[model samples]
Target: MLWLDLEGAVNVRDVGGIPTDDGEKIARGRLLRSDNLQNLSPTDINFLVENVRLSTVVDLRSPAEVTSEGPAPLTRIDRVLHVNHSLLPEHGFAATAEALLVRRKREEERYPGDPSCAHYLGYVEHRPDSIVAALRAVNRSAGAALVHCAAGKDRTGVVVAFALTVAGARREDIIRDYAATGERLDRILDRLRRSPTYAGSIDSVPEDHHRPRAETMEAFLEQVDKRHGGVLSVLGGNGFTDDEFDALHRKLRR
Candidate 1:
């Protein structure tokens, strides 16, 4: 895990240099995963744009969150293309407590064993189109592509996992990368807790709810294999063409 020393973001890292099954390694500095970019400092912005050469930002934040937070600094950059690929519907005027309760109930029902796995599954079940679109945007990027959600743990994790799987990265490496978020859970939660958009929600949640376990991602990948046959099959089922799949693979693998 190559962590980026950004002024605002804590969970940012370059998801490269992992060994693939075919003895090839993922290209360095081409793919990054991070938490929200709303608080990125000017220096952070310049670092990403100039040093990282970030050309595309695949934001998986919901419409409601985006509206509340306003445009991110990267969104204002002329050379960088920001794409919103929300996996869930915008929360209406419902009370926060009610929305959270309903979401928890749905996640519990989705997967009885692990709530994290269920929440990840919901991303695919609820918005297959958005997942496909996000992957397509990643494949289309001319330079480095950064994928982020609010915490860069769940939605971002799933998408990054898919990208790594498609690139033939070792399963152990994938799980290790997913579990790496747990190392920075405290910082991530603190940053999110300071944000008005997530403060109220995260304040009421347990610490474990914010942590990412290797088992959660292991189960998620297993479910994907068992239910959808594999990552490629899931992408194909979700309308990703063969050429797009090939392009994504080529973009990641050296």
Candidate 2:
């Protein structure tokens, strides 16, 4: 079930069964990606924790977002571990005037044609530790690990892309997985619009501006390859050892 139909989450999807680089495929029930889970119905929680065997949630929301959004439904679940490793700059949305200017220039320099691509790069550029920690959490989960952000597009996409790269997934499949979120973009945006913490940002931009395009992820992976020797290199450079990677490979491969 790549695109899950949930009452609360508009962009829930399983990140399994995709083809790897050498023709092997990702195993089912190992990973999932999704939008915010603040309002997940009881049934939705049951399906994930029971059917999916989701044991850990790698939340990529910043401290401010976590504070703003409050506790999620999974917080009460005894066996589900919650890990927070925010992939945003320290100041984040509350950056000073000078910081905003510097970030704007960096965004322009990274990918002038698409601010979204620039934002994706900023995840690794700003907080490589968070990305690494999120992967570690995923690898360490007792059962399935689910990664998510508010929209499950940029931050979640970057982290999942790195994990897929480590798992030897095909590049095209990686890009396709990121772009697949576009099929639910309208609902994603609508869900965010009702969120007190995220609505302002969602409404400030036109709906089309939030649409996930294949080129955006394509460019991100290209830039990652050009600048960081690709996602595997990024993981290795960040202290995620080859041994750790082998374990992830074994866990994810069919």
Candidate 3:
């Protein structure tokens, strides 16, 4: 159970090896985090399907996002669950990306810490049905599961955070997982380029659209701490069950 350094995958990490408060570590390779798979190389796809034995791929993007950028087709995997949730504002990814990019141009303007970043996490907090749906799929999957979204840092990050928390992972480990997105930026953007939306004009999207940085991801995670005390509250408040928590811990802790 190690995180595979796939040639074209961004932010791909084994959600394991972080010490919890009780001194346990997350089981490696049982869970993985990554950006969209729209441009997965055939080799990469084969590795996940044939070698990793991935049983599920939970997509957190909205319907428009998925339709605009179709993901890589999966094989005999049990299911490809689609859970629609807007990490950005109501209009969708394009609008939010542009706003973030504009903010980036102004002095002292930074992502992750910006007010917009809070709105992104707010949506996740107030409305977690989409996130829960993805987790439920993971619960039902037969083997390893890979979860992703565009850049895999915000929406995907939050969901992965909740998953880790449910599995009793440490906050520091969760932060490290979010921070890994920065290391895989180029690999993610390369895949973004293959999307039809990736070719749109700058006016239509943000300059930082393709790059999901660690700083921004950290800001989002910080907001989760500031707002709900932790991911557990977010899930509990939103409707997750104690049984689900126990089940997730059992399934992921090894």
Ranked candidates, highest TM-score first: 1, 2, 3
How far does residue 183 in candidate 3 sit from its true spot (Å)? Answer: 1.1
Candidates 1 and 3, the one with greater lDDT: 1
Q: Which candidate model has the greater lDDT, 2 or 3?
A: 2
lDDT per residue for candidate 3 within 40-87, as digits (tens), equals 676886788777777678777766687786545553233443334544
User: How well is each residue in 161-210 modelled by candidate 1, as lDDT tens digits?
Assistant: 99999888999999999999988899999888888888878866677877
CA lDDT, every prediction?
0.88, 0.88, 0.66
Best by TM-score, which number? 1
Per-prediction TM-score to the true structure, in the order listed = 0.96, 0.94, 0.78
- The 10-residue segment of model 2 with minimum total lDDT is 92-101
Give the Cα RMSD of candidate 3: 4.1
Clashing pairs in 3: none
